[model samples]
Target: MGNTPSRKGYEKQPEKTTLFKKEPTGITYRIPALLYLKDTQTYLAFAEKRSSPSDSDAKILVMRRGSLQNGSIQWSPSQEVTSAFLPEHRTMNPCPVFEKNTKTLFLFFICILSNTPEHRQIITGRNKARLCYVTSSDDGQTWSQAKDLTESVIGKNVRRWATFAVGPGHGIQLESGRLIIPAYAYYVPFKCFSFPIPFTVQPHALSIHSDDFGQTWRMGKMLQRKSCECEMAEIIDHEGRSHLYCNARNTHGHRVEALSESSGAYFDKPRLAPKLVESRHGCQGSVIGFPAPEFVPNDEADSIGGTTSPLSPDTQTWLLFSHPTNKTSRRDMGVYLNRSPLHSSGWDQPWVIHSGPSGYSDLAHSEDVEHFACLMECGKESELEQIAFVSFNLSDVMQTVDKREKKEL
Candidate 1:
């Protein structure tokens, strides 16, 4: 698989549906996080509606509902989920995690004081950010007032962070009822080489989790240094023990991945996942795990033995990953599958989604329809101009089918 050329070999091409377009609605729209509510059987698409493409200009968080009706996604008009009209402050990073037991949704994000830009924060080593969230019982039809959680959940840790952000994508809830919001914080280092820069800084992925169904949240130990912009997945291994899998953005050529044995309270040292390389500075990617497909025999191995071989440890479940296939440009969004959750080499060659301009994406599965959906940033001219949603069946990915199925609102 390593020898497979990047962006050269792809078979399947699914239909692309535009969910949110920039302008007349908002001057600019980006950073999408898609959530599928099982109870409501609805798709919630969240994005930052900004005055411009500037990071600090997104004053409002917008959402839209898409009902799963008769095998098609029928989208509703977009509405403002939350906004901060106060000067120099804006909401960013829309990350939502559903609590199955309570049928509640928690939307987590960061409020940044624009007076201090990210570059200044990186240099000064002080984060002018607050963690906040809103809840909904009616599957995004209505939402509770936004609540600030920085003081209680992060507390003094903010003092050490230069800048921090929660998932620009979706978070996950484990089978054990542990809810986690994947996040990253930039920390300024004490040592500096006074030459090209006055100080050094690094980012690492961490988790803020809730055990009591969003009543309270707690910080988890940070993953190894230099990881950022992560997404989390709950994976049950062959041993029957549940593990938290983290796939994070990295600037060091490849994606950073780690596993947590303690339901995301802590993670082992992170390692580079070579199969999932990052584009340029890095791009946020999406990951999801589904039930493993029935095992098929390898003809070469079967010829050697008459006895049937048991499935490998990696076959306990399957993981689906989405990201840009190119190492340099955020184009050609691809979906990768891996039967082994722990081994980096197990990822199959990607099945390309958008062969043109594409950026950050979030993945969700529909149990009723037995298909997966990808909400991503894509454009005809530039990658960040519009947010689109695409759906595909598991067979399309596994078989690499070259087909497109269109469904319009």
Candidate 2:
């Protein structure tokens, strides 16, 4: 499908409902904030109750479920645990992670500017724009106070912002328990933030590591790519060797998704996928990683595959799922798929997996997307399900169909 005209071509299904939607009670249902969910059994879902989205005042509002489709898995009403920040400073971008060595949960988040400058402080010395984190316990049910980790994890001189500030990238907690994070600097003309002198695009990424859990993080190898806010996954080939996949922004203003060799090393430049999910639009989301029984066709070795990927004849391939859009307000979003023979074919088919509204999702290995988190709906937890909990897991395909059927029911 390399020649597929646009990403929107591959059609599978559409989201009947969002990961979480606004209920009539004025509270917004939340997809789990971040990387906390892994297995099917356990995950924390969250949302905020704000008079408005720009209010910056949000509660740590939390929820948990038992299963993906067991029953009603809606979250608790949004709470105003506004935390210790000032009136303008509130919790934002709350993602969950775990350090296997301690069995402790890591909460990584960015403090969006609300009121004063240096107001939303975390690391105690520098007010970082791109990165910061928090720790958690009991499956993200509660959290440690905010700590501005950007300066500790990313260099402060890397990027710049105007009047207000902007932050760098965020990451996921890998199966190896390595905190894989991405960061970049940029200027938002809307924020009306001024520039230094002659206009220049912000140099994007520098990968970081946290050997001592989230306490003391240091910069590792630099990912000189022009992409920012990368979400990563370790894709093991049929040979069991691991590689990394990241979706990023290139200089061309197109939201391009790329691949890499090592767990988080050299990434191939972003190629023009079939559909362009407007990462530039305010509606951009992350790439949730997945592998399936049918991910790679068995005879993929004979497939018209590219040379960048390993030559794999394996049937099981790895999938990159993203909601690409041609334009921001364009509701005709496609859940596009790019396949690579896990054995070595490189990413093939910039094909379609599902389509509908562009929202958020983390790859949950199962028969259905919604079923992955049903554990939360049932109010129970399982230790065996592999789920990557993102800010929002896309609404389930089956649930969407069932809802359509119920309309007739």
Candidate 3:
């Protein structure tokens, strides 16, 4: 742990507003997916409205619209996406990606059988989930009917998977106009030669991508490593080359990372980021890339293990990640910085934004305001009490890091 930020100053809190609160009727909101529209200066927050806190209890998808005003977000009331569902099935995992050229918002999700749990599918070696999406041309005011892409996109590959799910967060659109939706599947290996075919399920991360805008789609090759519930970002290295960076959930005590040079068509072997520890049993995290700042203080760079060389803005891409910081439990929602996005190291100790019980989160960067927004599950007693929204800038992250550095010295 060379100069890693200390775990002090947990009491310093950022201003947050609860966008989706839990109800006394056992209705809970989980799996937040956030997206920011640069053109309209607006934010779209999505989540699963579950009958209870369990995955099998997920009921439907809901969203809220937030407008930037006076440096704060004014969020509208939550609305149920009735059109983004199939009859008699439960909707879950709201993964939204915006196609800038057509100004269309595609909210991708999986519909599982009403009472079918993921574990059951894995054990039985059968898939009962359908890949679907609903598009919104005018932001999220109204959505088109859900379209089932299971047969068209996945097609024959569905037989290899016991189960699969898209991002519980947001997706990305690359500079070349390719839309990438981070996803994972529990693959059933070859069956054993027995009366009852024995199955071994292994999870791997992959992407559902469309190069010709949203007109056509296909699945990318799966990662060789065991990863799941992932998010992707496009990073331009210092040498002016673009790469797709994937950070995924794993049970190996550390997060898994892989890079794709072919715009997500395939990925290289993944390496675990030792600095980024995973919560017990694993939890979903979010990653996004933005242009590096024009100047960075030497002390700050050294403290976070970053490069100090001078580089023009937009020449290199820096990353920000959000997840639960605690290794043994899901708590302390933290935001981490990686000045060197192309490398496995240089991930600084996180700036803990929410210090109490917290769970799945999504991060979005607003270029116009140079602010990052996070929609997360946090509460005093439980992480599932409500879905809250918070925003901070680079200065705020550095200030926290700077304070911790002085305390350590």
Best by lDDT: 3
Q: Could you tell me how far off, in angstroms, the CA of residue 305 lies in candidate 3 after the best superposition?
A: 26
RMSD of each: 6.4, 10.3, 4.4
Better of 1 and 3 by TM-score: 3
Cα error of candidate 2 at position 47, Å: 4.1
Where does candidate 3 stray beyond 4 Å? 1-7, 193-199, 297-315
Stretch of 10 with least lDDT, candidate 2:
375-384
lDDT of 1 by residue, 1-409 (tens): 0112325453446777777787764488889999988776889999988888778677789999999889788999989985322345788899998998888989988888864578778886768888998888888878887788889998987777888999989988888888999999986556344321355678889999999998999999898668989998888877778888999999888889999999888999899998888887999999987777554443445568833434555645678899988888888888988778878777876788877788899999875444899999987677877898888887667555222211111
> What is the TM-score ranking, best to worst?
3, 1, 2
lDDT of 1 at 124: 69
TM-score: which is higher, 1 or 2? Answer: 1
After TM-score superposition, the amount by which residue 135's alpha carbon in candidate 1 deviates from its true location, in angstroms, is 0.5
TM-score of 3: 0.93
Flag regions of model 2 displaced more than 4 Å. Answer: 1-40, 47-49, 55-88, 116-130, 158-170, 187-195, 220-225, 249-253, 260-262, 265-283, 292-317, 327-330, 341-409
Q: Write the per-residue lDDT of candidate 3 for residues 1-409, one digit (tens) a residue.
A: 0122225565366777899989999999999999999888899999999988889999999999999899667889889999999998999999999999999999999999877999888877789999999999999999999999999988988888888999979999998999999999998877554211454588899999998889889999999999999999999876778899999999989999999999899999899999899976999999999888876545657678855655454337889999999999998889999877777887877898887789999999988445798999988799999999888888678667766767888
Model 1 stretches astray by more than 4 angstroms: 1-10, 24-26, 83-88, 191-199, 295-315, 401-409
TM match of model 1 to true structure: 0.89
User: For model 1, what is the alpha-carbon lDDT of residue 318?
Assistant: 77
lDDT of every model, 2 decimals:
0.81, 0.41, 0.88
